[model samples]
Target chain A: MLILLWLKNKLAFIPYFRFMQVLLSHSKLKELISSLAKQLVEKHGSLNEVALVGIQQGGVAIADELVVAIRKQDPEAKFEYGQLDITFYRDDIRKNILTPDRMNLPFAVEDKTVILIDDVLFTGRTIKAALDVLLDYGRPGKVELCVLVDRKEHRQFPIQADFVGQAFETDRKDKIKLVNDEKGNKQVVLITG
Target chain B: MQLSTRHLLGIKDLTQEDISLILSTAEQFKEVLQRPVKKVPSLRDVTIVNLFYENSTRTRFSFELAEKRLSADTINFAASTSSAAKGETLLDTVRNILSMKVDMVVMRHSASGAPHFLSQHVPAAIINAGDGINEHPTQALLDAFSIKESTGGLEGKKIAIIGDIMHSRVAQSNVYLLNKMGAKVTVCGPPTLIPKYAAEAWGVEVNYNLKETLEWCDVANVLRIQLERQNQPLFSSLREYRISYGINRQLLDSLQKEIVIMHPGPINRGVELDSDVADSKQAIILQQVENGVAVRMAVLYLLSGRN
Candidate 1:
């Protein structure tokens, strides 16, 4: 009976794992992250006073990767990195409540250039919520949005990403996610049912 | 995820999962309280009215502070000062408040099931502050939060609810919450002060001996002797009750193991608990008060998420 139950669980999970199409492979993702780091350096010249605040859970990995890439280039990049949970500020809370992620902004954002990072920029709602959370913390000198994948259409709010790894058109029903493979390699996949 | 029930009428209405969620959410809110800017914009567009029929100090302030920290607009209505003094009904008063575009109501009444009745009649979300001696849900949540903070978790921990178990909403709420969370509970007080069938009805141990109850439990939640709530004499005298059940320094020092002490406030210090015990390092009474705001913030935040 236990074996049958385990087999049923595996059968239920197989289709979800098998049908996903990889939009960005592990190597491509690495290159994209490195190039994004270079782009950030090119734009900011130096990250001494700039701070990278990742929208929690999804954006944390990308932010970590970008920090490592920048450190490899400059060895002394002193940009402050933090994670922000936008659960409290979401506009769709009345519809459904999601569990809050960890928030760890140790440094003050006052008068510093804050770059808000996320994995995918979809309906612009998460970024909007992140902005509200940021302003409540302190008044930053300037704020910029950074994302790896930007769905170029169907934005319910007027918001845009300042830095992007890739921009594409996706169906409103399609799900785009950045996930880790079993070997601990990062990859982007589009799951459709 | 949101809470299972819309109205926090009592701990009896909450599932084990719901209690855990509220505690975890409160953990996050506790971190928020330590921040430089301690206010969050979660309930910015929401307006809550605190309708307190019974006089309160801590619970009222804690709920109002929680609402403020969530950035919700608030209006406080005390029964002594409000139109309720003119014999306005609970439904009529609440309907009048709801007519002013209020989204939620935090209420406390001397009558049990008052919040439950208000919830059925109104479209607004209702949170029971304390409805007579029935249950105080938020107080239990805060108590559980405090216990978790001190003792790690609630599961399998022996907690003794000491003194005035019959008259205490705090004790009853703690019993329901602790039982649901897999904690062992014991009701300890004089025979008259303890409810009949507390052991059978709630599935908790009943012990009249304070020393034995203190030795068996990890945490001792001593309740206040509510002089105002008692219409007739339940105990012989205050001095006798003190000699029998009051937690003193010498009794605690004589215990084989160190036990955490707790109290729901406005303590009749000499009757149920001594000053030294209440102020000792082993006591988390003040931490319980501080956690009240955070737990309440989590409750309001989660409930406001529901449609």
Candidate 2:
């Protein structure tokens, strides 16, 4: 009977495991991020005029990668970096209890072309909240959005990212997992029905 | 990690995570206070009522300043001139204030659990400033915030809360919060002033020896002896209490390593702490007072969230 139960569980997991596919591998992620950094520099004219503000948690890792890529291309390039925690500024704060991470902005955002970075762009609500919080710090010369995975159909707000690594269509119940391990292995996986 | 309750009635009602959240949020608000344009539009549309049944100068002003900094519309209600003096009940008075569409109530009452009682009856969010000898949570939060700033963190730090432990709401609040944040808390005072059950109840060490406690602690939070609250002499006399528990310059110099001195003021000059010690570089009483505004702002902002 125990063998039968184990076989039943294995049968159920097969289809779920089949649907899980890696969208980005470690090398591809590095190459794509480096290209994105080069593109940002090209658009902004120089890295000095550009400032990268990463949303807390996942976005910070993506921002770190972008900074490394930018420096790889131009070793003398200097870019303003910041990390913002938008937990307090969320519209659904009453429904959810969120403990915000530390918001560290060492440099001024004023009169700079601030490129807001995030890992996933789902409903665009997090970006909206980030925009609200960013204004409290200072007014920027221009604001742009960058995301690793843009769920194009899931946007609730009239928001769009200027630069995107990849875009995918998924069901409402589907989950996108950005797995960046401690060993510097990066992979994007889609778990869906 | 989020504060589950709408009302911050006491530190006893909060978890370790909840206290940490308040302190972290306060850290952000402290940065806002340093800016040229200090006001934030976080609570712009929210209205708060500062209802003080008991007389308070520091707590009341701090809450008011915090509310103003958040750009919230504030109304100050004192019991002396209010309808409470004209034989109005507490429930009726708050109901009247709520009828004007007040979103929150920051209250300080003489009776313990007074805010807790009103929290059940009213729909508005309640913040306990002080309710008798029960708790002064924001004061505890600000104290902890100041200590965290000075020491980098509260974990593994020794804090000795000195003076009238039995009657001090600040002492009770501090003991609960400091312990939760991984700080070793020792309640030091005269035996009469330090209740026997304090050690058993709160799991804090009770010490009568002031010099030993001072040497043991990294920070000594000296509480003012409440002469107004006490009905009879708990200690031998004021002079005896000062000699036994007082944090003076001589006592300050005796310590091998410099420790931070803290007082939740209106401090008695020579009672629990000496004047020189209160004004010294080691003292963070003023920093505690300044952090009070930021901590209250954080509390008000967190609680003001609604659907």
Candidate 3:
């Protein structure tokens, strides 16, 4: 009765719910992650233990969402979370201010599918950094990249996102911002200079 | 020119032409942060190092986030755990990192002249994060930027940096920079912190009590009182510190609502300022934090030659 009652109320709350979403709708990102997970499993066979590594700060949330999405898509898929602190790996560490904490997953990554997630896809250095760190974590069946926004711009590295939400263009100066709300509404916008 | 391989050394190193270029660059950068697409193309191949010896969350993080938004490679090195802790000398570490060939270095050291030292030592451009209560030039610039952006400009403006003037690199830097930009500067702290002939060097007025100074100033930039700073007794207690010189709701009433308030924070909420006052409408502390990134971005881009 409580589930039915909640479902009825949720149906009523749909329009306003979608309108006020900030970053990305949990449902939508979940849907995207699910779609990607389905393709991965269908090609590579059933996932045993899958590890989602976020690129710290922004990427962590996306990885968490993807984990939930993967579990929902394939109930048999075991999930693990990890983060990379690439501060030390950075070339400019000596000249910057304070470093953010290294949020790392202590679990072993042997024989796991490590799908790295980040909020936005830029020049891929951050992804490159994450990849280098994840390589040290352990050998995995495969490493995949997923991002919420993949702005079609010039990238310094030879990497591409396996799963991309939307690709857009920006001037050399303007920025691409994706804001995710508490309710999971995400607005991706292109700013002008 | 590539934005990646430049170094930002000091504010004084920036010519008026360089200053204008950085501000315009920052203006463009700020536009990107507001856009739906929050990533910029500048500094694509560049790497930025956040080397902070001083414990600061605001300025340090602002630079970090700025580097992130600009699509530049960023590295953070706090003093708590690093070669600095390994008893490795600062120049030795800088030389080692320089050998690694990182693009730019943003440095904050507890020792005064550390930034200047880094400037001399490193082949990479060095932006002074904060040096030993000596000169937080960027923080000073951000405060000026916030005030200028809000209240027209700094020309003929009356700005007071109150509390713990002796130990405030912020006050010292702000005094020189704001005066350079044609703002009337006033240093007001308890008599001990506001020592003899201190204002004379900067050619600014000095004030003792909070009341007259609060009324006279257009901007009251409060300094965080390092309680550990008093080698001898300056104030009796935190309560006495608050009662004597703290900027609070009562102090806010003495000035017009438009008069901006500032603090280089990790603010001792009740000691140097009241809680609500720090977050109040007059308080541009957070704005100062935000402007810090944009200003430092400008500073870094200038010294970096990647411009």
lDDT of 3 by residue, A67-105 (tens): 676667778765677775554345443355222334566
Q: Is candidate 1 or candidate 2 better by DockQ?
A: 1
Alpha carbon lDDT at B189, candidate 1: 91
Each prediction's DockQ?
0.44, 0.27, 0.02
User: How would the candidate models be sorted by DockQ, starting from the highest?
Assistant: 1, 2, 3
Q: Which residue runs of candidate 1 sit more than 4 Å off their true CA positions? A: A1-20, A40-50, A68-79, A152-162, A171-174, A180-185, A191-193
- Top-scoring candidate (DockQ): 1
lDDT of each: 0.90, 0.88, 0.70
Q: Candidate 3 local accuracy as lDDT?
A: 0.70
Candidate numbers sorted by TM-score from highest down = 1, 2, 3
TM-scores of the candidates, chain A only: 0.88, 0.86, 0.70
lDDT string for model 1 (A1-193, tens) is 9996666546645565434679989899889889899999988877988999989878998898889999888887788999999887878776776677788889999999999999999999998889888887889999999899999797888999999999878877678998998898989998754
lDDT (tens digit, per residue) of candidate 2 on B70-164: 88899999999999999999999999999999999999999999999999999999999999999999999999999999999999999999888
TM-scores of chain B, in order: 0.99, 0.98, 0.90
Which 10 residues in a row give candidate 2 chain A its minimum summed lDDT? A11-20
True-structure RMSD for candidate 3: 16.5
lDDT of 1 by residue, B41-160 (tens): 889889999999999999999999999999999999999998988998889999999999999999999999999998999999899999998999999999999999999999999999
Model 2 scores a C-alpha lDDT of 0.88
Question: Model 3: per-residue lDDT, tens digit, B78-158?
Answer: 778887888988888777766766888888887888877777666677777777767777777788788887788788998
> Candidate 3, TM-score vs. the true structure?
0.59
